[model samples]
Target: MTHPRPPRSVLSRLRSQLVVSVQADDGSPLRDSRIIAALARAAEVGGAAGLRVRSAGDVRAVRAVSALPLIGLTKTWRTDTEVYITPTPGEARELAELGCELVAFDATRRPRPHPVAEMVAAIQGSGALALADVSTLAEAEAAMADGADVVSTALSGYTPNSPRQEEPDFELMRALTAAGIPFFAEGRLRTPAEAARALDLGAHAVVVGSAITRPDDITRWFAAALRDAAERTVSPVTEAL
Candidate 1:
């Protein structure tokens, strides 16, 4: 069955804009829906064009506070499959029903509980656009062929098939661009410069997460850098000797 493409107005609003992912991992102190709502508000104040939120509670909280378009998903860890992002059709429908303009799901080639087309239909049937999070160009193409409205580079570096690196996957972005696939540049985008670079590489838009929302992750990144610097430093006495 054919699904309607995402509205042009929604896509136009996101073009060349920053979409912040406001989510806190399980066991994180900031995992509360209230905190997520606050962060979403802060993102809007900071000029985020859209939000990528996780879980129904957090999405509801964010919706209560901000009018920015939302890209929503659920991370469910199952012993059966590695496909965690909005793993089930029920989850995708729930995210769309909760007012997400777009529902994101793992569209990687790994074994999944449901087919990519089923997930796409679920989202579109629920009145939302389907945004497939993929790790490779091949996966992106497959998802589009399966009726996904758009793809995001959010699974890069997370999948074993993709390059695991400290930097954003510019290679994948370039590949997607060359393939003429419109996509959101996400995952490991840590700075404004990197975000801008993704757009220069032909990304539909940029999605930044840890650098803006996850203070714990941001602190760890800084702490690790400082530790590395300290380890590289030699004592003054050693230098004198």
Candidate 2:
């Protein structure tokens, strides 16, 4: 089937800008669609060039409140396969039909229910650009070859084969840049400086998630740091002894 080509203007709007991922973890108090919509509006007010939203319900909610370009996906856990992000073509089509400018899907080498080309076609066929979330350079290359419009370093640390680290996958970004693959810098980018650094490293755009929207995770990070610092404090009594 000949699909309507995804508009190039949507990509132009995202270049060198921040795309806040406004998703709440399962069971979080902020999981409500109303709260997600509010957070999306806040991100827009803060000048986010776009938004990366999860789930069809949240996408509809955010779409209702904001006009920024949306990169949409569904994080459904299937016992049959580990590829959760928009694992099915039906899910990808739904996101595009719901008005997402781009649809993101897991593009890793892990066994999946569907082929990468099929997923890309689904997104493009529904009139949205395909954003392949990849863990390694090989996956990005494969996804591009499979007709993905762009790739993101969103799954770099999540996959077992990729480097596991506390910080964002700068190494993967560098590899992508060196190989001349267009990609978005995502995953564990915690600060504005890091986001700026991503732009400096040849990323098409930067996608920030937990640092901007997951308040519970942010609070835990701070709490853990404080606890470690308190443990390391050298008391005067100890010094004297």
Candidate 3:
């Protein structure tokens, strides 16, 4: 059966803008939807292409504030497994209700046992598109088989075979791009330099977090820099004396 192409907003269709993931954690975004909304608006005003939000409340808040379409993901976990992002059709369905234009999920091969194909159908069924948050070529290939509308290199360094190294995994991106899959480069992208590199490597877009959104991480980065600078050895003996 043919599914309607998922609704794409003007902002979502653009490829050059930044997609900042507002970490909708329980501690911050969860506790304060206002902050999430404000940031979403700021991001929108700041020329964000889209927002990758975790919770439904955060999604609603952002949607109400800005016209920026959302990529929704629910943190569905079982028995110590840290499977954030929709792991089941049920979770995807729930996210769609919250105005998620494109629902994001972990499309890895770790036996979610949720019938990946069924999840895709459910996403289409719920009137939302699907984005596979994958790591390697294997996972990306599998996600296509399961009908993922888009594939992302979000977990490159976090998964086992997906090396935990820097760089945008250009080899995998090239492979996916060769296969006609749109690539979104994510994971440990801490600088604008890396963002440029990902685009050069043919990524359709890039999602940056912590480095842009999470102020706590920024605070720590500056603090650590200061500490490092303070600890530097004194190398001035013949200056003005």
Candidate 4:
């Protein structure tokens, strides 16, 4: 059976644009779908061209609140494997059925219940493009071969095999570009300059999350910076004492 091509309007609309990831952690105060919807609306008003939302309920909430393109995903933990992002075909299919334009799934080399190709086929069968969340160039290549429509640099630092970095993984972006793989710059993109730099490094687009949606994370970033500054400015005599 053949599936129709993903909506071109969505794909074209997201090109060279900012896709905000509005996700609240497990214990976050703003974990409710209503809050997420408000955040999505705020992002749209603030010029975000698209949204990368987690959970089917969140996707539906965001979709109801904005006309922006939506990329949906689910984070599930399993003791058997490390591939938590959309780990199963059922999750991918459900997200697609929620009217998301794209469904993001883990396309890494980690152990998973379903093959990456099966997940991709499931998303396409539901009329959504499959965006592969990859950590390495090899994973990206494999995802493409497995029929992923797009690759995102989402799992680079999360995976044990990929380099752990405080900043965006420009090396991975460069490698993907060199391999002629178009990808979305996603992980650790904390600033406008960093996002722009990713685009300059050949990212198809950029997705910003904690920096934009998680106020707690942003507050911590500021607090850490202030602490570092205070430590750096401390007097030599005080340090000696």
Candidate 5:
């Protein structure tokens, strides 16, 4: 069976647009749902076409505040598996029930409790599209084959088979495009330039997280860059002396 497309409204909203993923890590002060809603509203004001949010509470909050398409997902760590991004069909169903236009789930080769097809069915049955968060080209192929409406490069750096890079996985994006697979560019997309470049590379859309919503992560990025620059300058001056 062919993968079912998202609602035309959702697809039209996201085409060549930015989907800001407003996720705060476990210990972040911004982990609260209120802060996530505020970030979603800010992204809306900043012209984000959609929101990719974690957890049902965050989804509800964001939905309450913004009218944009929402892609919901859950990150649950379990002892049995490394496939944590919306691992189960139940989780996918819950996110869809929370008003998610699409639900993202791990579509990697890792051992998963619920088969990819089952999860996709659950999302579809709930009236939401299934977005496969894939790590490799093969995974992307499998996800589409298993009826994922769309695939995303969200798992690139997280999976062992995928390249570990500080930059966005444009190589994976290109590969997906060459294979004629529809996909969204995500993971390590830290700048407007990179996001734009992803679209130029034929991404259906781009999803940016941490770089936009997580203030702590953004602060660290700037701090690390400045520290590296300072060190480089100091080393050169010391050598000259």
Candidate 6:
């Protein structure tokens, strides 16, 4: 049986929930496919509201394992491309083939491989919802102008900076509160407290990663602590030998 697509309720839950991006950037796991599946299933079992999967293979991996509604993103590097998620109508169609209910893409001031309106039309043409990943009011407005189903504050401080990754500015979130579309607080949210704060400020959803599903970062935290402790542990050279 086909699962029902995630509704606006997912947006509402995003206010205080974590949507795990279980897939890696390479679109292939260094481990096994079952590892990704277990991670996604564990997230859902542990109360994650949804899954934001990258790549078609990762989507396929998670789809068979977890019943969580998926928000799919396909990352293709095109020389002329500035946007990644469903950058073209073909990518959008690919998302639908993989059973993505909602497709997200960059809706910034930069040029997109596929124009915003045309992309929206294509997703609509395919009967899937479109999500606008924007960083500012103007971008959000432009996406709304293009008929986006939901507006996300995901890429807010990344692009236009060039070379450095910055956190989402609180001012942008404040500005987005009045945009008349569902507001999703994404990127760099470090803890559950921050998630609560975003929703309290009227955000529709808050997408968090690194802190949850990315064990590499978390493991580094532990490794650094061990390194520091090891440094502090003094032993007589002869005894140690």
Off by over 4 Å in 1: 1-6, 235-241
Decoy 4 TM-score against native: 0.94
User: Model 2: C-alpha RMSD to truth?
Assistant: 2.2
Best of the two (3, 5) by TM-score = 5
Model 2, residue pairs in steric clash: none
All candidates: TM-score: 0.95, 0.96, 0.86, 0.94, 0.93, 0.81
Candidate 5 lDDT, tens digit per residue, 64-141? 889899999999999999989999988888888778889999999998899999999999988799899999999999
Best-performing candidate as measured by TM-score: 2
TM-score order, best first, reads 2, 1, 4, 5, 3, 6
* Model 4 C-alpha lDDT per residue in residues 1-241, reported as the tens digit of each score: 3456567677777888999999998899989999999999999999999999999889888888898888999999999998899999889888887888889999999888899999999999988999999999999999999888889999999888899879889999999999999799999999899999999998888999999999999999999998999888988896899
How far in Å is the alpha carbon of 241 misplaced in model 1?
19
The residue ranges of model 2 lying beyond 4 angstroms of the native Cα positions read 1-3, 234-241
lDDT (Cα, 0-100) at 81 in candidate 1: 100
Residue-wise C-alpha lDDT for candidate 1, range 166-224, written one tens digit per residue? 89999999999999999999999998999999999999999999999999999999999
Q: What is the lDDT, from 0 to 100, of the residue 187 in candidate 5?
A: 95
Global Cα lDDT for candidate 1: 0.94
Q: Weakest 10 consecutive residues, lDDT, candidate 2?
A: 1-10
State candidate 1's TM-score: 0.95
On the 0 to 100 scale, the lDDT of residue 37 in model 5 is 97
- Where model 6 places Cα greater than 4 Å from the true spot, the runs are 1-16, 27-32, 161-166, 220-241
Q: Quote the lDDT for 5 in model 1.
A: 40
Q: Could you tally the backbone clashes for each prediction? A: 0, 0, 0, 0, 0, 3
Models, CA RMSD each = 2.7, 2.2, 3.5, 2.6, 3.3, 4.3
